[model samples]
Target chain A: MACSCVAAHLFHGGDFGMSVVIQQIVTGLSIGGVYALLAVGYALIYSVFDFSNFAFGCVMMVSAFVAYYSILAGCSVAMGIALAIAVGILFSVFIELIAYRPLRKKNTSRLFLMITGIGIDMAVTNTAVNLLGANYRPFPNVSVTEPIMMGNIAVGKIDIIALIVSLVALGILWVFLEKTKPGLAIRASAYDTSTAGIMGINVNQVSIIVFVISGVVAAIAGIFFGMKYAIYPSMGTVSTKAFIASVIGGLGNLEGAVIGGIILGLLETFVSGYISSTYRDLFSYGLLILVLLFMPGGLLAKSKSDKL
Target chain B: MKRKLLALLLAAAMVLSLAACGSKEGSDLPGITAGKTIKIGFVGFLSGQDAYLGQGAKMALEDYIEELNAKGGILGKKVELIAYDIGMDPNTETANACNRLIQQDKVVAIIGPESTEQAMVAIPIVTEGKVPMVVTTASNPLVTVAEDGTLNKYMYRMCFTDPYQGTALANFAYNDLGLRNTAFLGDVTNIYCEGIQNCYRDEFTKIGGSIATEEGMMASDVDFRAQLTTIAESGADSILLATGSYKVVSFVAKQMRQLGLDLTLLGVDGWYANELLDLAGPELEGSFMTNMVSDDDPIFADYIEKFTAKHPGTTPNVYAYYALDAMMSIEWAINQAGVANSTEIMNKLETMKDVPVFTDKLTIEPDTHNPHNKTVSIIQITDSQFKTYKLYTPEDK
Candidate 1:
């Protein structure tokens, strides 16, 4: 139905017609895949902690820099990815331990936690700026710059790889959450942190686990973003979309995060492709408002009227 | 009674010192005595994200000053630069800097606060303070003229206004390059981009070139694939990139190629950065852009060599050249006026003609307060480097 809606716009006199629509969809899916990785990470933390992690974008930035410098130091792309993941996990865990754990122990309000996240984000961004100057550093050894031509439509190899990897990662996470014992503990903590602790689930360990997962996800997304765009200090600003995606998906629901991300990406591309690129953001934010007003629980969110 | 007397004496001493400190900085107006050093005020971003731009302008101004002093100074008095860092926020810091330059430093003239926002802020202060300021590289039309078309007589700009560059691009694309149909892509959020884009549209349409589509994106956007795809199908042979960031230009160029949109890319001065080459070298191989001055031009050869010698490991960018031009304008005004008085210099600047600067022999139009008859160099990316395509001057309509 969405494809048809886009196709209808093309009949108004585009040369390439349906091919342009196909290309836009491919690009949208790729960006959406990256957004999903970030949204799910945000949702994971929110489910347990009940606060937005504004610093999530900064962690992605750190990972991108790690990956960028690693490549510059003559490491292979695979090696760079591995190093980024390690650094991302370390940085996220450290932020949690230093900034969040103590606050959580004090039983501070969620607003305080959100403020701390903002502070951390600003500090990280400033430090990165001072350390590495604000020049755009393009990712090296991204071998798939060429697009594969399927008939008349062009498909980026990186986009295909990104989409497949994101789906696979999300699938594995789903299996882990549904079938594994530790995953059950995480779910329990998501339901009620104090009750989970009382039931001997070790909520602090779950927090660590959640952050580690977030790190891994951020590392992958950051690398892809760096490849698609260039690595810069403020590349984490793109995480604004992920935050919006999580909101549209229902803040703490992983499945909803995926759906919301894809929806946002597809709608953004459609707006840009058919209508006007300037309206793309306006449309996305408009959809966000409409979703909040009408379906606050989000598209795939479970019935939680009290939570809303 | 003795302690009270001591306190009163201390207060008197502090007031006397304050009065002395005020005198040391001299009068709150731009002027020069026969043997007194001429104070030139400079305000720009010194520390923050835009520090590099400010530093470039500062260094260029300082280098020019050093050269002037070595050559027996302007009007036989040493030219002293009183520079203040505006930091980042133009709204608050620019006013303070302009005020300090006018009231405290008592500079003969002021230069810079390079961005349009800071330049506009300096206008009211400079006018009230009765000081003349030559802003370096604030290209907006409203920098010198208000929205109501009232001129800010005290303010002048070193670079060509935004409309001039846009018209030049449109003329070059239509008459020179023979491009009949084109598409426009610009950052809607940036005034610089929008200004040029609007002018280009107006001129391009007036010249009989058909615009297939016009698109807008945010300055912060890193992705241009969706936009490029739409542009590809727009049936245009070329596209105009009115974005202010080299990063965005490179992204668009690369994505355009990735999607197999093989159209000619035309850009503004924003695409002239070195990093643009690194980001999308092959993609932008045949693309064209408009710039202030061509490096290959003999006019800037001496200035470039001297500037490079003065500042090692760095060649001067457009900001440096614009700063040099601003300094030259000030020197010319002082020579023409036969004094360093602000009102006299401003009067000289208004009717300034045939003043030779590093880029061109400049003539500031009294009405617009922008340099007239300035050449816009057309640059093309050839073999991963900027090559001088042409030195174009848009014919007066």
Candidate 2:
């Protein structure tokens, strides 16, 4: 009732209301889309490796720097983005070989891998600090300021572009995973690594591909993050929220990640509109803990084992 | 066997004599460098989140030390500077660096740990060691004072505390801009923010201004729409933000624009950065901030010229100037004491008054151990750059 009253005050007086709410929601969705992509990358890696890739965020940070420096070096925006993706792929492979492969050979447990992941994260994050120095660097603005009008609601170019890109990327990923041979191999590897290896599928190679894909997605998220907010050494900390989203969405389920991301976005927008904006993260985590206690299996979870 | 024994005895005698010669060389410079060199160790954030501050401090120290050495060193002996990186985890690294410097490096005096957290941690260490220390950028008044009304004899700061900067902003807003009603958005976690907020409240209320609303946000928060909405509805003519992180400041600016709030914004020295302009875009145009150091100051211009001429390719920053001035103050104390002893330096530092530096006429009051008669400047964001409006001194209205 209080929220409605405020809404009425804003609407009737032409002060602020539906348009502001819509604007907030669009902004949240764009941000959440970036988070979702980042969460998907973490989920894809975790599902296969049974360990959270902490360096994933640093990988994103480093890719952002690469993109920034490339643009400064006289490359076009598109070329800079491509270079960033390439760097991400290479860096992910290097990290897997140097930091993960040795531990994998020892048949490290999930806990051990998790500890190693933290070490990698610290080392990589600090290395960025050493090379780039600790200062916020602004990305070159793309100047896509034209707002698109969908009926009475107006959306900025960034929001529309983000939504379209995220949806397209997810669609391609779904098609590839469900309808392609490599996707089937990846699924088989996820189901049982040894059996997939015995079935003439190179499980190690598939894992590498998954890591590379995750790196690419993370890099895309980082570029958008830099565009939206300024890039800095500690920017990786912001991704932890997205990781929470993945767990809430059902850690291994791609659909769950997407649903979790959208729900988180909408909830934040609504709460900022009604309750308060400062408590948005608090409400998100509170709802997540609540969902975990009751449902256990996320809102769209399917696997019986996942319910546990 | 007899020949071999004779040769071994001769070799031992030669080694001992060479060691004696090395010791003699070390002890030759008496008075200023009696027994050993005067080691001035520097501990600051050299790596991790805020490494830029450390880098700036390091460059400034290098330039100042070079200048001092070129002028025949401090007290007629070459000054030795040993620096340690505290990263940005001040609680752990500051203490560790202090112990390493005092216990192991045997430094006579120390400089820095540039941030408030690190400086606070270094206070006890230096006091216990009875070593005089000049903190590089700790702007909190608590750094040089204790809870029991005792001044920290060995601890000193060269930067103007946040309270003074806050009062400067209040004066600018009320007296210059003619703003009477204000709102506040402050970070609850940061001592720097809290200090500035308190000073702003005290000074603003003292000037017949009314605070319309006061809101708190965490430093890590990236959104300020709700807070901005409340301020917009509070009918305040202006808002004051006391926050350290540039990201949150820019977010507040953006949210203000989105809500169509036309209130003028004023901030403390924490808002001094080009990154704020880039992040806030045109939304920050006409917003004002109080700066203890500005590029337009003639003293700063000379320092920049000398620094750039030496370093080449490195841009001069306010942090660098503060660090250089801090070291210069230490040198002045050493000169006034006329000895390199810690007790003498501490005693002389307490008596210092009206010592001219590049930016202002700074003096340390023995009672409070806080600087007096410091200069502050009012600056506004114009065309994505900081432009100086007027300089404020303690004598001026």
Q: In angstroms, give how far residue B123 of model 2 lies from its true place.
A: 1.5
Considering only chain B, report the TM-score of each candidate against the true chain B. 0.87, 0.87
Residues B344-365, model 2: lDDT tens digits: 6677787877787655667888
The per-residue C-alpha lDDT of model 1 at residue B128 equals: 88
Please tell me which predicted candidate would have the highest lDDT against the true structure. 1
Give candidate 2 misplaced runs (Cα > 4 Å): A1-24, A46-51, A93-108, A141-156, A188-209, A266-285, A304-308, B1-36, B222-236, B250-262, B274-283, B395-397
Tens-digit per-residue lDDT, B277-312, candidate 1: 888887788899988878777766887787788788
For every model in order, what is the iRMS?
6.9, 7.1
**Model 2 Cα lDDT, one tens digit per residue, A49-96:** 666787888888889988999998999999999999899888887888
Q: Candidate 1 regions off by >4 Å?
A: A1-15, A303-308, B1-36, B47-52, B299-302, B394-397
Candidate with top TM-score is 1
At residue B340, what lDDT does model 2 achieve?
Answer: 65
RMSD of each: 4.5, 6.1
TM-score of each: 0.90, 0.84
